[model samples]
Target: MGKTVLVTGGNAGIGYFAAEQLAAAGATVVLGSRSDAKAAAALTSIRSRVPGARLSHVRLDLADLASLKTSVDALGVDSLDAVLCNAGVLVDGPERALTPDGHELMFATNHLGHFVLVCLLLPLLDASPAGRVVTTGSFVARSVKLDPADPQSANDYQSKRAYARSKLAQMLFGFELDRRLRAAGSTTISVVNHPGGALDSLTPSRPPVHVRGAGQRLRGLPAGLLLHGKDSGARPAVRAVLDPAVTGGQLIGPRVFGLRGKPRVEPVRGGAADPDLAAEIWAASVELTGMEPV
Candidate 1:
């Protein structure tokens, strides 16, 4: 039997491709998404690509904390071999939208929601011999200046900054999680990976959203000369979950300038390695989520 795995935002983009890779390698994937229709469509898409793929969908809304609990409860699995915290928000509608739980939308969806989910699912992860959690991050995280004073980014409210802060939170949390797991003598590894500038514009996904391939390729050539499509970007996260060599807390990204290349161990930057900041972020997440993971 294949290992049981779960992936957030598995309905599209890198998450969708990562699910395909995992399912193709023999695993039962419990996909989580906000939309049932999208999840269903994604399942069909995956099945078309990988025949006999074991897949299921769970309705999850990061904006709604109650829904998150209910969604996990719906899954009766006692243990999960791996979980990819792949769901996130980038080009959201509102400039500074807040979740139903009163937290910043991007911060909640990209970081806090995944944080709570991982903590809640620790038992299931512990049940596996070598459980893993891989959180999706981005090169944008390198520029974030996450301030505890403005955790919500309500005052500044720059869309790109908000998104960057959220991504940085995911990276910090991933490292912090591994630290805590080690401190507690657990084997479950928590790692983070970036899709290497995996722009939707360059990828040809079904139902095609944002067809800016030629333009993005031309425009991004200076910064991301070889920017990856989504499938290529998903490779690093998949490796983080499946690779035995990937130790806990290690950062991973595309080798070629983090735009388009093979997955490789990369250095953490932009104050992301500060232990004090990680603890602060953890405390903030726990307070925001209203619960600490066991």
Candidate 2:
């Protein structure tokens, strides 16, 4: 119970599984969710699986700036070994929804909220011995182009395109974080992971019609036979946070299609390899979230 770890959106899906695995490994797992009931449910589920699991629940809503700060306040301020930014949402409707802070929903929840949380906790993290931050990205990062001038996709918002763009931001943040922290003489590791395509049905939103297309149908075999399990998808994330072999800027995931095979440290996409774009995204994120780098 000494090494502290927090997982945003850890109440369900891949986040829940990651928390469970980390708990089983004897780390204090704090499940962050907007719903207290769901957070309790997640804690109970983890205990049912691992009787000795050290777990707790805290409120965290990525869509609301005040909620983010409130959740950060509720968390016990202590040196954290790692913070897994796994909370994300895929808003697939035609209408563009703005967050409480008046930012795009997908971008705010998937990227900015975690960005704020990481920055707020960076002081505690930097004070720890070998603290780390791990962010969950997606294979969709390959499909989008990051235009700094139009970071929010305000002019054109295609549902799937918006989702892809958010993922790209996630990857960009990971790379830029590593570069900046190293330059600042902080050893905090910033690593990224993608689940490829896993069968995670915990999200409350529906996928856009086009997103539920032929690929999903062809791969509609069996959850076990086709898509990777949440545990399998979370392997790279687990390694990134826990394994000493893992390093900053390393991308981890399965080797096979949709990354369903064994997990390993991998390289991110080339388009997401722009240092300049990453820096711009970092600055934008700080401004958007009102979070200062610690």
Candidate 3:
């Protein structure tokens, strides 16, 4: 039997391309989307490209804590070989927004939601021979530091800062999970990857899911030299989940200056490698989400 992988936000953007690539590699890709219509469209798009791709969907709204358990039960799988925590929210508004759980929108969706989902799925992941959790972080995370005391950004809130910090929190959780799993002597491993400088204008058209106009292609030509399309961006995460050589706690991303190139194992630096901060963030996550992996 082929390996089964769950990819959150697999309905669009980098997540869509990642799911397609995994399907092409013969893994059973389960797409976690908030909408059934979008999930169906994504499934169709992948099937159109990869004939005989085994695909399914589970309704997942990461911001809504109440729905996570339902989403896990909906997976209907005996074991999950890997989980790609790829979904995230980038709040564009100047004002802060909150999820139904009363946590900041970006932090809840990008970090806390995946944190809880991973906790719920630990059993299934453990059932696999070599279970993997691939956390999708961001280049923006490098410049920001997370305040565990103010994880929701209540005291200080800015759109870009919150988004970056949330990603930083997710990366912190990934590394910490690796350490905990090692201490427990479990077969599961956690890896983190960032899609360096992915732009929609540079991305290829996927028809009904996403279509780039002629002008977009012409306009994005210059960026192609420095940056890359989302298809290329999805590679690092894909490699993290599939590559046997990738060990726990390793950071993966583009090879050239951390921006644009083929996926390669990158060094963990800055706040991402700080064990003290990771532990604090893990505690904050448990406090905020009321969930933790066994």
Measured by TM-score, the strongest candidate is 3
TM-score of 1: 0.92
Candidate 2, 1-294: lDDT as tens digits: 356788988887778878878998889988889998888877877887888888988888887766666787788766889999999998878999898678999998898888888888888789788999999999888978978777889999887898888988988898889888998999798999887677643212122201234555445555556566566677777777888888898888887764587778776666678888888888888777777564
Candidate 1 lDDT by residue in tens digits, 153-270: 9888888889999988888899888899999999798988888888665565555322455676666556446786788899999888888899999888999987788999999877
* TM per prediction: 0.92, 0.90, 0.99
lDDT of 2 at 131: 91
Candidate ranking under lDDT, highest first, comes to 3, 1, 2
Local distance difference test scores for all models: 0.84, 0.80, 0.94
Residues 155-264, candidate 3: write the lDDT tens digits.
Answer: 88999999999999999999999999999999999999999999999999998999999999999999988899999999999999899899999999998888889999
State model 1's lDDT. Answer: 0.84
- Candidate 2: count the clashes: 0
